[model samples]
Target: MRTHNQRDAPGLRDSPSEVNGKGTSGPEPNKRRGIRGKIINALSPISVGKAKIKHKKKNEEREESKPITVDQIRELIHEKKLFEAGQHLLMMEKASYAEQSKEGKGAARSEIEAAYGLLKQEALRVIKTSVRMAPVNPELLQNTVRAIAEQVKEDKTAALEKANVLSVRPRLWKEAWKEMIQESVTERMQVPPFDGVEGLSATAHSFLHMGKAMKDDLITVVQHIKPHYPNDFRVCCVYAECYYQCFSSQLEGIAQFELGSGDNALLLTWVQNIYPNEIKKHRVLEKELEEANLGTLLPLKQIKHLEETYLINELESLKRCLARCLQMEVTRWTQGREPEKLDGHFHSELSIDAIQAVYGGQKRAKDITPDLGKQIAPLLLVELLTFLQSYKKELERFLKDNKQRQHFEATVIANINNCLSFRTHTEENTMPGQNAVKHQISVVLHEIQNAGFEVLLQGLFQELQALFKKFTQKTWLSCSSIMNEIIGCASNHMATLRTLKEPFRQAIVEKIHLHLVREHIARLVKKKVSLRSAEQQGQLSQVIQTNAATLHAFCTENGSNARWLEPVLPRLAEIIRLQHTDAIMVEVGGLASQYPDISKKHLAAILYFKGNLSTSETRGILSVLDIHLSATLPPTSLFSDIKLS
Candidate 1:
């Protein structure tokens, strides 16, 4: 029935007689003599030492009775009570260190150290379990990995080894890498005036550094993750960038060492290695863009802008790389030569075969065959054409709807602006050896004029040719209607292409006129005509007149060069005149035959007065018919005998 404190420390309960007079529990002072007590206290140090030893032993026993467990440490870790867990582990290690300092306590220290190690192991297991629970969370993975890294940082070799193993897990590694990239971008964004190559390079360097630090780790992670996101453009771009950093570093070093040394074999090797996949990526991006459906809840303008922006960035990156390659070649070729002498010296070095090789031979060998360094120009032209062609059908479809057309036009304008801005940026940022690169870009632009016009003409010609062929076989009314439709379609296309430049506008109009309208008219003239009755003849006459008049009006309204239609107009007019004259003669004959008493004078007057007949020609016809004319009756009454009325 002892109190808890007394039971815990029985010496205090049994020492009442030895307590101090002030009621503190302690050994009682001896009453033999005051001087004797002082001498005894001063002489005995062993008793005080024994009391301290006893107190330390009791504290140790109390600690051992309620020892910390690995499971408790793990629970704290699971609760994310990391600071508390660390404190507990630190306390345990400190206790072990203290115990090792004690005499005859080597085995106790070993036991404490083993417990601490087990606790650390449990903490790590808990972290792994948490990560597995939320593997896809980038922030969580990043934080957990960071914590693990910090925890093992004192043993850097072991920490890096563990990090390597952890980063190889596909889900964990991707989230960690993406988080790193996003953090880098955020950091770069914090700086001011961030809008050019410097900003771009800063951001790119983050990825480059990470790739350098974790080369195999990054590659392993990417290879494992790519299958799940095949068409993810961002992932594709990042992957390309990693490859670029890995491969370009070696190439860059080689170029720097070989600069102005007249050795381009190294640069060419780099080009051959890098260009194939880069060009292949372009084709892949083009295919993806072509297959993308713009029909969604998202605004068409935004969708188009994003798609175009992605493509522009990719193309610009390729262009920049190509420019760098060209620059290196220029520098290499111009070594030991005066700046003036370097002019046109590197032209022949730029070959389509090299470029075609870069595209993995996807382009026809014939198409890419170089023309005195013009091969790169046309190769790039083909790329631009492919981009435009992919969107052509969709654009046409867009034009069919008013709202879509407005959105499409806006997108086109935005794309053009972006192109201009890119060109200006390239020009402004020209490096030392980029003159040749600029020349190549200019050549590509020039080639686009011709190539784009050809594509435009080819498309319009095919369409109009079919329409013209259809017009030639149909009835005149149907033919006229088809012609009008063709004209309208051509007009719309011309208007659209006019956004490009004068060459495109002029070429489209000229081609449509020459191939469709002019051909249709020429073929119409060669058609056979067979009139079986007067009514049929009249109908034929009317159809011819209406078709001719319609064609004339269309040409006039459309600003067509009228000289081309000169040969066909007069023939059509003459046919109408002759049909009218024939009708007039037939009517005159019928009237004369009905009135048997009709006089020759009346007949001559009637014939001369007919609307379609010329006066002199009418008189000649009267003489040929053996009819006589007399001055006889009054001029106004001369036709009185021609009718009974």
Candidate 2:
């Protein structure tokens, strides 16, 4: 043992020189034992203390590595550290899945649901703002969608694992978000100063505006907000569904109400026409909207009711309109007002108005009342036929007293001109009742046309009556100026009638030709000129031939299109000029074949003009014409209209 100062000196206590000295021997046993014991005593407390500190650090590390608690999750969420909160949520779900305690699992499930619910609430608020086209921070929308995606993952995992704990938690948040989409649409759509669709045209116009505005809002969704959503959202389809439901509800309101024809038509127009057109008008929207597969705006049963109701009502309304137009026309006729002409042809607004009424309704009908044009056409035509018959009877009644009226001929001509408009439109048609109506209508128009011609011809013949009586007399030469004078009077009448349209213009020319031929033949049948000499017969034949030539020239120049009747007068003159009865019989056969309506009296007149023939000869000549008289007379017959003495 050394002194205290020497002993306390750090270098002297464990001197490296003394320990490393080669001559140094081991310390005595007692001394070494004492030093060892002292060393063990000093290090014992330090070893124990260090072992406790190592165990305590391990406990702290374990505490740091464990997942966050529910409280801590809430704090992170409140701090807007959603990423860390989401990690905590997943860990909580996994731990809840592993937990065997029902009570503890239930508590964890509740907290997880509560946390997800808060997230969904925030997400929905952003979605609503975005769907409504309100400006929002992009990050909020991104975060919202990310949360939903995670929830979707949880939903899928729960489904795959059949997770009993996750079952207790609210799930299918994606589906819930879809429901929110519908709710958003409903909320946006209900806002309105709604229009009343109680009237006819007003209802259609109002609905069109509504559909257009809705489409515009949806397009705004596609442009501004849909990008923030995932493709699985199918935002377009959901938007379309909500819009369809809203529109369908409004239409149901219309279907439940009692409607008139016009009102029903307007409703159907919106349902079938304007609505479909509006949804498809935007190409971008069309593809998405069709995918939604929204059915018609109204039920089929309701649509059928509206259609039938509209049809029946429209029929009655058009009938009333037609009756009114007819009455107005009759009133005009009674007042002696001439029906108007267009482009030198008679034209009536009644036909236009009649067709327009049906077509206008058909145009508005869209798909409702299929083939409305075909269905409604017959009604108008039948009504018109009835009115025309009544008109013709009224004209016939007026015609008897027409001579006293100053404007009778002009008014009749105007009415005749107007008939063309009706006839041209009312021809062989495919509409119901078209054939029967056309037949009756044609008869009535024909009678009116004939009466009109008689009126026109009556005036023309008056000037030429004295000249016609001079024909077939002894002074009447082969080329008499009387025929020229008659033709001249006819020419003057033709000039006055030139304003008539084609077919009518040619018709009048043909009528004059037939009348002249009939009158010329009538003179020969008078039996005044008995040509006992062949020379007199020859002279009369020459005169007849020359007059026939002159009449034909005048007719063809004035646009007479009657080609078959051209040879009648020339052939008759040939029979007179022929001397042999055999040749004349053959000639008479040809003439009879040409004019099937040639009668026995007409043959006798021709035989009497060539008076040298014996009675047997006359009998023989008439026998050749017998076969033609019993045959059917054509619609256009010349000799049947002639009077035989």
Instruction: Give the best candidate by lDDT.
Output: 2
Off by over 4 Å in 2: 1-115, 129-131, 134-146, 187-191, 194-202, 217-232, 276-282, 327-341, 345-348, 361-370, 390-411, 427-434, 462-466, 628-635
lDDT of 1 by residue, 49-150 (tens): 899999999999999789786567667666655545655655654565555557866665555456445544443443333312333544433344444333
Relative to the unseen true structure, what is the C-alpha lDDT of residue 108 in candidate 2, on a scale of 0 to 100? Answer: 67
Clashing pairs in 1: 18-27, 18-28
Give the Å shift of residue 518 in candidate 2.
1.4
lDDT of 2 at 421: 67
**Tens-digit lDDT string for candidate 2 (412-438):** 666667677677777634364468777
Give TM-scores for every candidate, taking all chains together and pairing residue i with residue i. 0.22, 0.76
Model 2 sits at a Cα RMSD from the real structure of 11.7
Which lDDT values do the candidates have, in the order given? 0.42, 0.71
